[model samples]
Target: MSGRGRKIVWGLVLAFISFYAFLEHDVRGRFAARQSVEPAVIVPNKALAPVMAMGFHNLWADFSLLNAQVFFANPEYRGRIEKGMIFREMIELATTLDPSYKVAYFFGHFALSSYWNNWGVRQANEILKLGWKNNFDDYRFPQYIGFNYYLNSENKNEIVKWFRIALRYPEAPRRLIWTIDRMLRGADTTNHIHAESMCAMCEDAKEKEQKRYFCERCETYTALIALNDLRLAYLRDKGRPIGSLGDLTAAGYIDKIPVCPNGCNWLFTADGAITSSSLAESSTDVRGVP
Candidate 1:
């Protein structure tokens, strides 16, 4: 191999490396370009306001990967690693890598929300902030904010406000918009029983003896619903005796709220066991309101 031959070979290698780099950069640029045109993508522009720009910036995405041991440590297992923690850190890191990655943001938000009940609210707010920073227009961010506020803060006003904002988005449905409006105006009828029944369905367990406990547990919610009806009746009549609850026919608040389709009697049992068993054997319609 003479010196000239080696020099020529080295030049050829350099040219190949340069071509490869150019191709790689071009492909990445095109991908980024496509992402930019996507409506869902939260791309940040240079013109963004300082505070908002912070949210859109890729700063905190890879918080865990950069700190390997901090993420891998699990005293519970000698050598076993905490995969959830590692995944969480990686997700955050990905978001940092690409602040515009709404998927990463959502994934991180969900993980955090699971770890902390109030996380949904915080994540919603964070995403909203990011959207605002990017001057991005989307209903999901605000909707989530409102949802978190309602679910975690119990702040009715805030929930209403955010949900209303969500309505402005083209994707938001009209029915939800109306419901939010009614709730905000306090025109929404309170159905304690229905709400309770749904909740019981969510938490009640079935261990044979405890089987159909949720179905029976609905009675409590039903009782509350009746109580709510009574309250409304007293309010509307403005002097009606509050001693007993009136039937739905007489209650002016709602016009025939949904009942359990199971044909199960929701009335109080003579023995007053106050169990969901009455409806359990009657083909529980799980979707029943009362």
Candidate 2:
């Protein structure tokens, strides 16, 4: 409208046009650079993932698994991780995020089916094996492995081995309450199984505090196992049972005693066994909270 005002407006318009041009040029450069590069997974390493999560490891694991699920569900990306990175194997990043995550192993079949690819089947089994190893009582883990075998192999023994593991629990075909009841009755490895159950609860928990709580319960059972190992080692070396729990620390079997998450004391049985004082026949009660 006025001479000075008009000049200022014109100057601003020129500057805006120059900035747009620079931005367009930068975009083109990046597009060209990535044109030859294959898309890659943005996941972090399994061991270092806990550090990245900073205590919300289960949440991160859920995010990573969901990311992979969405990616694979895409019709364009289905059966392959990416076009450019054809040879790159998709590591199960979710498991790395929370190795104790129970369902991530079961979901391996999403890729394991013949529709995904041959490699998908193999990779799925690899993921399932981790689950099976950590969760021996879970029928689904071994059952999934058996399904994978049916997909790729005619090995009946391998198939039976997994199926037998699955059938060990009569409650496998029933509701979860039944399974939990049977486990509580007298399963020899009840503590380990309960620890896995806690991990499963952590996997499905909606809140951060709840997830962390279940995970801590799982860790208590893990500590029980470690402390027992120390007890056995002390017995072997000293040629007698430990008079007390402190002998393991004094003998350098462990740097110190593991604290129970329930704020209870760790017990040293007369037979040189360790257990949490909170639960009955054993101390590895992973089901309760403070």
Candidate 3:
């Protein structure tokens, strides 16, 4: 209301308008954009936002990598591992934060499927969903989906569709990709049948062996099928209350239990070779079985 007060107010209003204009000016547009904020831009090499959001320790995954190295170096304790659920949870939490962490995706799949059994299926599916959400155009997600169907859900159609999508990727492994392409080009074919065909499609004996390995190695339902057959053998021969691999073998059904690669141990072969994914060897009772 007073002269001096009114002048001060007018001066402040002008300064405020100038600041707004400065912010909106073309010269400032680039700096205002997200790309200009280096930290905000999603860097492929770094832990992406989702991975950061999960509150998982990067050190844990790193430790897992180290443990894998130890495993490769001295694979003496293949049978003993505990805390499988925890390992899976960490992997799920990590990939949930960074879906593109391919190593985590793959190792997570292996840790869960091979060691923890189908306990990893839900985590694998979660990873697949995250991949789909973040990078749908990437065929890797669909390939994972197909893998899950083949392993967990046993949905042949869904498996075929996803395999087809994976085959479209430029970086896909040609032999496997072409095998999937051929299978998807057909209908009503089971995975076992598809796997046999894939083996036959191989031109070289070594390549055929590799294909056979893929078919038997966690990628197929071999583990689950073997476990089922072993269970049935127990039920049929010795009844459900049976105990020990020796018992199964004595019953003439021991061959039903599947075999892992050499150096893999039989920590618990009473019912089957139930490996502990997250448990250390010191924690398991590996004394009784021969």
Candidate 4:
């Protein structure tokens, strides 16, 4: 086959794999519902990956990335990832086994930071940090690292100091480890820094596709940030929590609910927390709480 033919073949192969995985999950989810049992998900022990790799670490990393992509699409199962069952572990396994897996780092950044309520900032930054350590020449990773820090404004000084320390000693294992520790500890909620990052990525990213992706992600982030900010404002002004996401619009805080760039709908709770169905399964906790 020609080089172009080979590229096309691999593209189809990956698409097929992703589609099959999605279908299998869909069928299994329905079956599990009928059977009244939990969907069986097998996640590897990230720490034991080296032993299990048995000289196929690179291949294992690729598989981990695929799994990460599949799981990231279903926010319902994100709890599994958050509760230490899948999402975060897969990213770690992929990057640790194959530190140069650039896509995994990028994928992790978006997947981990899907929560506007600050659920995945720590995980996203950790992935970004790992990428920065291994692929320091990539300015995008460092730029994003700084952007994620903007979410947690109170710890700005400490994060700035340690983040710079990490930048200075990218190759030092001990220092990088400590800096990552510091970065994870101090985050609050999302803010409207999305526009800045979005604009910066548009100007700096070389690829058109990548620029578009960042554009959508930033728009989504701005929506979430607005939701978080106005959620409080509604509480203070109305003397109660929002009755629904529409309440924000009804109250004139935002004109409309921003559809997620990921193509999944976002969810709102009465208490004002923002979660993404595109990032996780639609939340049931919201209805139960009220």
lDDT values for all models: 0.45, 0.58, 0.49, 0.62
Q: What clash count goes with each model? A: 7, 1, 6, 5
Query: Candidate 2: which stretches are off by over 4 Å?
Result: 1-40, 81-91, 174-290
lDDT of 3 at 129: 65
- Best-performing candidate as measured by TM-score: 4
In model 3, the worst 10-residue window by lDDT is: 38-47
User: For candidate 1, lDDT tens digit of each residue in 25-55?
Assistant: 3344546656773111122222332243234
TM-score of 1: 0.37
TM-score, predicted candidate 3 vs. hidden true structure: 0.36
Q: Model 3, 1-290: lDDT tens per residue?
A: 99999999788666644543342234544676565531111112233434432343454345444444333233333323444544554555445545556677666666555554455665566666675676666666777777666667555657755665565566666566545534442433233544343333332224444545444333233343454456566777655733444565667766554454333433543334433222113334544334
lDDT score of residue 75 within candidate 2:
65
Q: Candidate 4, which segments miss by more than 4 Å at Cα? A: 1-31, 78-85, 158-290
Clashing pairs in 2: 276-283
For model 2, how does the per-residue alpha-carbon lDDT over 160-196 read when each residue is reduced to its tens digit?
A: 4564455455445634333332333233433665555
Q: For model 2, how many clashes?
A: 1
* Residue range 1-290, candidate 4, lDDT tens digits: 99999999788666755643553344566589778886766566677777766666787688878877876776666644444335777788788889899998988887677642355776788788889889977756765666566564544544444444334433433334233323333243343333444444445444456556556655766666777778889989999987667787888988876666666566664335775553333354544221
